[model samples]
Target: SQQGEEDPQALSIQEGENATMNCSYKTSINNLQWYRQNSGRGLVHLILIRSNEREKHSGRLRVTLDTSKKSSSLLITASRAADTASYFCATGRNTGKLIFGQGTTLQVKP
Candidate 1:
């Protein structure tokens, strides 16, 4: 998101543990999105929350955005080995341009 920095570039957690990733951006955004990418595959959009929204959830995934801080976080609950992937946050502006974060690699061990 806006060429933001993601905390814990790499993370390893147990299968049942929850995984959390944080991203901080440099500028304002219209909306923010989280994506997941498997080993060598393309990114899959996980969730998108508008600037007006504070939080959103999908299944075991929770996403929170703080426009005030220009930051966001993604939380994966009850993580599984299959959840192992690289997660990225992308910020969209009124100009229709999207800037992505460096991404956080999560490894869920069985």
Candidate 2:
């Protein structure tokens, strides 16, 4: 399968804490993108790291990629209750379709 599945499926964190999630996939991919969905809003792109890259950071978000293991992880630092939402990882391949796994829901409490 080309899709990536995230572990835990859900996460809860304090307002000032950090949250981490892991995803594992079954095939080779060109790149991986992390997206955030806030309630009913459409998913907003958070970050994208290419297959050759190992790690990347954007503001409060950090992403790690391991092409050898066909997996990736997303970390949110100093999370806020406003950050409460669902996070999804999409694996992009030559097939032109991004396969998304069941997402991980994050709840941040104030």
Candidate 3:
């Protein structure tokens, strides 16, 4: 079953500050992915960290996963107004099924 939740349903920050979002899942996962959706647009893949991995980074995006705790966090450093979007964390299982979290809406003001 898809069971996940992201903390801080909404966040507001100034440009250049960092934004962090947390996600918690109820089951084991093969891999975890973070995505960004700009308003009405499709989700843009941000980063993916495997079950064996504890942390990963892509450009200004950083992701950390704790399988034992069944939780993950996404951090965006030096956030920009353009970074304003909804962020989601999805868990992928051995069956190739992906379960998504509710998402965190971020607003970066300039």
- Estimate candidate 1's alpha-carbon lDDT, on a 0 to 1 scale: 0.94
State each model's C-alpha RMSD to the native. 1.2, 1.2, 1.1
TM-score of each: 0.97, 0.95, 0.97
Tell me model 3's lDDT, rounded to 2 decimals: 0.94
2 versus 3: better TM-score goes to: 3
Error of 3 at 40 (Å): 1.0
Pairs that collide, model 1:
1-100, 1-101
User: lDDT for every model?
Assistant: 0.94, 0.91, 0.94
| Superposition TM-score, candidate 1 onto the true structure | 0.97
| Candidate 2 ranges beyond 4 A from true positions | none
Name the lDDT value of residue 15 in candidate 3: 100
Stretches of candidate 3 above 4 Å error? none
Question: Mind giving the per-residue lDDT tens digits that candidate 2 earns over 50-75?
Answer: 99999999999999999988899999
The TM-score obtained by model 3 is 0.97
Q: How many backbone clashes does candidate 1 have?
A: 2
Specify the poorest-scoring 10-residue window by lDDT in model 2: 1-10
What tens digits encode model 1's per-residue C-alpha lDDT throughout 16-102? 999999999988899999999999999999999999999999999999999989899999999999999999999999989888899
